[model samples]
Target: MEGKESKTACSEGFSSIRLCVFLLALLALIVLAQLAQAGISRIWAVDDGEKVKRIDNNHPLATSSDNPVRDGSEVSLFGAKNEVSANEDGRFVVLPVENPRYRGNELFRAFENYYSPRVRELRNRYGLDAVVAGETDEWKRILLLRHWIKSSIAIDNENPTKTRGDTFAILDAALREGKFHCTHFSIVQHAVLNSFGYVTRRLGCGPGLKEDGGHHGVNEVWVNKFRKWVLIDAKYDVHFEKNQMPLSALDIRDEIWRDGAQSVVCVVGPDRHPMKPDSETGKSETRPDTYRWCSWETSTNRFTTFPATSTSTLIMLQDEIFKKNTWYRDGKPHWAYGTPYMILTTRRDWIEWTPNVITSKVTIEDTKARVFLSSCTPNFRSFQTKAGDDTWRDCSEEVELPLAKKGRNCFTFRTINLFGVAGPEHRVEIVYSLDKSEPTTPGTLFSESFDDGKLLNRGWYDGDVFNISADEAYLGVGCIEYPWEKGHTKPSGCSGVRHLFEPTEEVYLRCYIKLSPGWGWTNRTYHPHLMHFLTTENGKYHGPAASHLTLYVEPVNGKLRLAATDIQNKNAPHGLTQGPLRGGYNGKLYDSKEVLFDDSKWYCVEAMFKLNSLDVKNKRPNADGQLRGWFDGKLVIERTDIIFRSADFPGMKINQFLLTPYFGSGLLPHSQTLWIDELAVGTKRVGSVSPPDSSAASATSWGLMLERINQHFPFTFNGAADSAIVYANLKELTSP
Candidate 1:
């Protein structure tokens, strides 16, 4: 009876075990199915066009759009209701319209600091490209760079050099002390990767347990091969990998949690050899415990000026199962752990964002679609676009594509780096309709010819010292004049005119001016402030010399200049980036390469000033503002990237115009008379005055001006390397 019962019990146990195994297999399938669906969704969200959906919720992704959809979200495309979707190939996708409720809140700017001129100079000066030139594999190149830095600088934690994140200074110190800390290693590594066109961020790691004390600084670089961020510990010349795939900080932590560090492989040196146990410690170089917690610096470019700690930091923690409040002592946050000012996010996507990605916006009007592309690509070269079956064509960031058909219009965009590497393609589709209104033109805000010989009647103020003379005029018989006595700086008592209008984001001023024969230049860097614009943030009668925001359009040392002085903003939080606080003046100067002004000849001068966009939600300023100058219908000075104001003045506008020409106190060279005629201001270009008679003297004057320009500044004209080409073009345009 006992044998029979035992056999029966054994059989029942086997049956139960089989059932459990079956259930486990079924659960695994379900999980795999869900993961597959998620993967498909991610691809659709970024790559494919068919599954693209409007982000209606207040998710972080919504911040990428200027207009985010909210409650009762509905998007209209080509007079149709929200019925946009991509075709089967996913080659084209429809983008949502602008969301009015969405404020300008962006995780990253259109231009990242990795591509700044400073970084480019650093790369060239250090020959960073040649460091990895021989390496064919991208991963090998990264490893090679790590090894190079480690071999060059020795580790010295006890007395690390205090170079404060300056790569150049750190390298210079490396030659003397020959040692530094992990922070220095990571700083140099981060900058080197950026110089090579790889986006990177400094990572700070610490132990999770309170009893465990110590910290380590490393770097996480974006590797296009794996399409993910990989951890590179330059201090120890090591990296973590699993199944031949490089691992990130979070990856290492998760691997330790799953089983042990047995599966995690430690890769060391450019040769990609397995790391050996430390001679003294008898432990692996990569301590998994050290990566229990991780944080990244917010700005990658701030390392040159100061340590990453000076800028905002972002703490990234795992999911709830691993997260612990005990990480903060007494449940009180710490800067090293986490603080109120520091952003703490459980989402890994926020920390491991894709680099060198193209962001696009599409606007459809009439039979045309305007696609505006912006990117944070390092070493960005140009944007390439393809329409329908057309081959890819290199185009500007903003392009207008024609919609030949009424149905599906597909467009694909990608950004190319300086190294010829192309970013992931962003495909978009739009449905077009021929029924649309024509684009409207901007209207004139204010115009003055002085031909009326009156000021008060034409919306002019502060013109007490103004005199309308007929001595010389570009078009009309009357012109405004200001006379100076010999050795007298302001004998006319600051003679000028002011015009006030409704607040405007942009304004264009056009006028014809002629200086007295043998007119003299200030010869100093600054002075002879000619035309100026004051923002609405300041009083209408505010002096342009020192005000909240004063944009100066004048001649400095005979060169056309577009400058800004915001002495009032000297103490603002963002003052440092704008200009320096020298004594009581703070401003930035943008001068033309060629001197566009000459004496005793009427010249057409026009200037356009546009305010930069502000990320109001984040209180950040964009550097897309423009200041353009035209000399006799030819573009002389063009500055598209400028920061005119900070977020503190969100409502600022160019409301007041000043035509005050003054040489700084006692700085006027000599007595000279300046005359202006046919002055006009409007929301659009006011057009230029016709050239004077095409006579031999007129041609000679033009030739002399060109010669003087070349003599004063011989290198290039507005960054163009071929100055001869520029002169040739100018000669063709100005030929009699």
Candidate 2:
């Protein structure tokens, strides 16, 4: 009996061990399932107050790649690899591509007008900034400005000012006559909003085609806070809203059409109280039915070139029935056809477009995600980025964010304007895995150090007035020198060299140079042409001043300057967007604000030139070309919006480089000699050079001398801090 009992105990113990092992395996499976679920790619948009909404993968704003093929070492989130499927996992992702409907459209190019002198004058003349100084919220400022305009100018539709779109003229007439029309109020409000760096458009609204002369004019301002347009009727001191969010004209029209205008609320006055029928007049301040038909100008730059209308008018119809009828007996609606040209379309995007919204393209390489951001923000300041739960940090237009290897990673990007207003947020999320492929580095197209003391040996051509010298070199024992006679003013005294390479859309040039003591500038705007890039559309020996496209990099009056001229394209069908043709030479000049070069010391100067993208299908040229210059490792000048070519030269590229130094006829201030060395060019940025100790005599000697002085006379100085400051200021003034 004892033997039988012991055997039973052993059998029970074995059963209990088996149960423990099964439980451990089940728990492991559950944890693995949870991790796999968390790794699934998901996108979310976090708005103000941390409101998060999950966006579906099939949403118009979301784009994904199920089997992302590698482009070099990086995987693009769009293009041929873009495919969406529920079964496919481990995909690369990016969010909403910039709406192509507004990409390069001219009607959307209103940001440039904010820099107009007229806009600035209007802001200062009326104390517009002071009026909204206490308001931190951008929407509140918009309401405040509207109230100011409504209170300052009374309404009188009978004797409206004849100075239609001019803000100053309208205000002058209102001050004298004490009243103006609704059109004048909208014009004034549009100008004021633009002066404060807000994008606004004037709209003319009526009940429909049947409404004859009872049309009203109002303004629709882009509120970046909500990432939508809000209609404000300054003349009536009212704006439409639904659910606490401001409604655009189209929104109000849609709401009224679908639900009988019961949901739409009309808010009036600066206090934002609900609209009620006047106690004496027995009429509401604003009616929602007025937005049944809307018309607007294509361009918001009416105040930019006052008294000269350059934009077409577009009218939006509610349905096809309205399209067939005419508002006027002559079949030409005066309100819609007021401009030189007009178009009627039922497309809502053409009438109501959103601006100041951030759009991005993303790529994944290993554990890093690169985000390229673009926007139409006015009065642009800087871009801000947030990674996961991290704090928002200011970043450049192009930023690289890190991704977690084991789980989900998210990033958000937005634009901040100069007035401290933040635009809509663009978010991207991805599940990362390691990519073992090696990244490729850009190869050098051409390099020259003059260390071999030979210029004719390389692929250099047209070498003249330049010879290799062994004295005062920046990098090696040899450098190229150019000597100008004391009183010489002829082109023969200039030095030049040309190098041709494979055509490329972008190029960077870096060189170390030193000007002679007391080197003077050609005080006039033109001349002393230094370095130039010529496109393949021009002949190898074509003059840089006139070509299909010629980019100039030079120092003008001690300031680094980057300029472009396309005289060969001046007569193209598109017309010259950069010039007015001055004596067979015309171009736009971008000068650096700081004096970068003033002393006889070796300085490293680098310039980057990138051609703008072209929309061949639409036959339009985008004004997004870039030109940047750096002096001694510090960026001093940058111009992102430049028109380097027209559609006529769609295949243009930088094929030839010229290092010519010449002053225009009788423009050379004095005979000056300069030295050039370590010239390098590449498709990617050929960064600044670091000189050896022996070559960095000026900077090294000054720093050492200051340190010794501080060491000996410690009481006379504030220790290392004061000595460092003096050393830095003196270095900047005496050297590069």
Candidate 3:
């Protein structure tokens, strides 16, 4: 066991003597800078053997071909002659970034691209470019750049602060304000690292194992030394290491969840110990049988990061990465559109080839503009356009499909035309249903066969959505579903599992749900609690619940959505106490803004909740917990900061897995019923057992990282799957 730990956890190269010396030198510089802390805002400079060059307004370096490119004459800091080609300001795009975000090396291209002159100017005044230029080790260069970013961009907590336009404009804002936030800090680091030809990406971080799970911004540099991406949190002036090896955002997420928080520690922070771990269910709770819904949203709640997709997300995206939102898994949606050059659209659910299913004709269509519809997969295969609304001619010659796996198949095609206009690559996900004729194994987590006609009482309990019927079953004689009746208004029933007999850190729940022919027939409205997590006192039923988060099937803004939200704190008064409506913390609405769920289709809905521990620093009410859900293995909604309690409320815990299908105060558009079968709750990944690739969702670079993590990490590795299916380009995570 110790040997295994050495191979995976403890073997990262943080203990190298070279890095040790460099860190010591950097530490001394940090101390000296601290002594001159008063000038931190006014002048952020670095020693270049002879003088410290301040990057304030007094020292100006311009890159405008439209005007003079310099106010002061350039000086040789590193003794290397510097050359920069000037270009128009706003047209500069950083990175020309490749997909599989964390590992891409856009730095060289970005530094040499049109943005080079402006970037070089910024680098010269700051003086770190010379230091970075002198370093041969990518790792050391990253550290040097990290120190400058931390030293230069002071954290701005004041709200009156404002932002300018575009990436260059934001850099101007940062220079002017002198003070910055975590967002600006990463932006500066990204530009500086790229300037020195070190591939860099802005990575988003969520709460620690404790705390309110605030959104934090960190940067990852593709280090040649490690041959992999490593994290740098300039805000803390530290990086994360496990067994002394640097970590990526994914690594941090894995370590925090898989094995608890023991091996995870900060590289250079006052709190270098493990951030904390998933806390147990709080004591002093009530019976969940009496629990009802509570509404909450925090007006003053601010700390953690929000996804770039959300309108409420607060971050300055002046850099190209921000403008493009490439920090998260982003480009998977275009796969359905065939190829950009093809410009195809479809009414059929992406290429289905499963058992007992007919190859019905699926409508395929295309429009001029690639809305780049957000999907678990890509929207188009390949793409390029000469002029808007003119002609989007197909140039992708085409590629042949690969052999299909026994269970599922996937295909992709990419092309770059002679004009250098690249096409959006096509990614295909097709599931060849597992052989039902052969013996089917149970999912990695718990599996239920309703043939016995009752929920196993030991770990599972009966709740609101519990009605056994042999009418239609996935396998056994019985499948659970809402009582089907004419004009059913408030149909609600449920069954739940207490706590896993083994681990409690993270749990993935999977179940087979089939809408009755009545699924959405009422066509009026559908608010079905496909499932809900209830906080229990002792893993058993606790009542008058203080916390609960739920997942329901409802039509939101004309789209059928699988939404997730929990009970909000009533006393927090974040935005709740307006008048008669007394609000507490706000519940995050898990809407991916995509409508993929349809009725009458046998769908597998899976959810994983990594219960976040309560931290002393971020006390009461405010919570940034994680709740992820997938339909047919296609990610539909994700919520990282889901509030379930208030300052006085207890820690957020999901005790009861309630399959509550109900409409609170209104009736269904018409009488309608919902059906369910084969429910499961376990510590392992409980994914789709049939058609639609469970593994298909994970078959990418992100999937590779999750696989490597499961093997490279110790036995404490939390869940087998790194995350529920996410539709974006970069990998999405739910961490401590």
Candidate 4:
């Protein structure tokens, strides 16, 4: 059915491609000096180094036939050597002997072929070389170099493959792949500059460990014109859009010298600890000490050692492993959390798989108790659980499915326990066989049907239908009457679970939504209560009415925008009575921009509300005021701060929240409703919202995020919080 809509949303927008755009922009702004022969280029001597006077005769630096190349002067400092090659032209590029290999390094080849080509093209087109000429020669070079590197590569922690010996291979793969770690970029860029006859070396440092323990590396280039090593970080260029420093920005106190390539830092020795397990149980009388390799700051070139154990993610891997069990069993893992521990824990939903159902017998077992659990409607072949308890017992009831209409079957833990101790306990398994002969559906739908009872078979379908998606729990129903349409007054008729959020802290309710076909609307006399399931009893005291955040779903700029106000605060202005409006603490909308929403795509929408206003430091919020939103991944509105109290600007606190379908007039209806997943509410302000991970997006930028978050540390050690000390230290410097 056609529905009335607002004016179409404006399309003028600027999308952000962090890694790609940054790299391109950086490349465009580089200033490579092109000095003609005989030009007098300025070369400065270091505090402790000697300078040489050369004859500047007009000629091409590359093809100066008359000038004899002489070893005029050299300076050594740190662990690198800086040498300026007097090109035919008086101007020169710095050549720092960085590693064992001279000039031609693996990284050098990748840059010349892949990165430099694009950079040269961009530089020529932008004319940036001219814009940066007179800007404090040192400052200009630094700025240019910083921009080039920051935008060129995306930073990552772990490389896909295990290879790590050569920087060039790593950089080449990363640049080609559009993502890499800082170390990889440094290696590659060093090699490329070397190939260009420019000297390059590694200036590595770490956190005040030994010289090598610092674990930091940046490239140094010696420009004959400058007579010093211009420090540049190829890694920073590869991973970021804003380089931290420039080439001419010198911070070294002493002269710098380059050494053949060596590890930035490596801890050679091992530390041993007494072998003490939480439980003391060993058959042998002689118990050996346990030793785990940890990073250290040693005196060698490799100072700050980063243990492989600390860098890889074990959590995500464990999560993948957990999903395998689910897919292998009931077609999905029944994931939930335990209270206290579970309530405070973060939830990670795994990628959903297409289902292929085959004939199978179900089994139940409690691994913790080492016993098989009982079922309610269990058939030797098929059934679901409805009872609560111990022992491996199949339900007395038996059921069967038609050979046709075999969809992936899933189970929900209703009366089952996750811990196998208290509450309801149950563990179920299915056994079936896969049939490759069957064709798969081309959408997120059921794929195959297994008729055997040996191994569980699973397959998937793909489609664009938003009704069924990878992130949904497929609930099936036979030819029963539409429960809501049949006027079923039971709470279960609404089906959707009511989640009551009691303020561990105050929260804001924001979401992107669409309604089901024929979903009813509300009139003045009738309004549906926003249900809050606060108790596990299912039939216990329902939360009080009027405490929920009142919401009305309506069309705003051709998209569904949920307009909510601070209804919990009784002191604010009342809301408009008609056209999808509800009462709450109203604030001025002096300037309201259009809201963006995707037709079928998921939009990342966020809302933040102040929880208090009375206490200055930690005051109770008057109303949730700051209302902002995004569509796809672009910010659409910067709503005027929702001021609750007229006296204090933008004064308001938030309480109670809700998400429900429209209860107003049904005249302006939507053709297809929306499905929502990944709903988050926070009291803290959300700055940039990341788009959902999809294959269509560039994976290189993922490297940048990986480098920043260092998610690897948490995932590697399971429950051990100490796996990521490096990340922990790094995060401290940039903590918000």
- Ranking of candidates on lDDT, top first: 2, 1, 3, 4
User: By lDDT, is 3 or 4 better?
Assistant: 3
lDDT for every model?
0.64, 0.66, 0.40, 0.28
Best by the TM-score measure: 2
- Residue 589 in candidate 1, Cα distance off native in Å: 72
User: Is 1 or 3 the stronger prediction by lDDT?
Assistant: 1
What is the TM-score of each predicted model, taking all chains together?
0.39, 0.45, 0.30, 0.24
RMSD to the true structure for each prediction, in A, is 32.0, 26.6, 32.8, 38.5
How many steric overlaps does candidate 1 have? 2
Which ten residues in a row are the worst by lDDT in model 4? 285-294
Off by over 4 Å in 2: 1-106, 161-165, 173-177, 209-212, 277-285, 307-312, 315-321, 328-340, 379-381, 387-392, 432-736
lDDT of 3 by residue, 1-736 (tens): 8787766643665445545444445543443343233111121111222222332334332222222223222211111222211111111000111221111111111112323355456566667656666565546666866776666555664441466422344456656765656666666666666555554556444432122323455566655455355767675567767787876554554454445545665555323444332243310011110001110111111111111221222121121122232222122321112232221111111111011110111111221111121211111233332323544444333322333322223233333322122333333333222122212234334456553334555346544235665434553335665653335444544343333334354567777776543233333434443465555423445431234444344334334454333333334444221122225322334555665545445677777766544554665433565667777787776777654333443544444555445543444443444667667777666666542233444322111111111001111111212112110101111010
Off by over 4 Å in 3: 1-445, 456-458, 462-467, 487-505, 521-526, 537-568, 572-586, 613-615, 618-624, 641-652, 691-736
Tens digits of per-residue lDDT for model 1, 179-296: 7888888878887776666777888776645565456889898776676679999888888888888899878877775576678888788877887556453133367656766776
Answer with 1 or 2, whichever has the higher TM-score: 2
lDDT of 3: 0.40
lDDT of 4 by residue, 581-654 (tens): 24523312211255343232334444433322333454333443444545444555444434332222233233
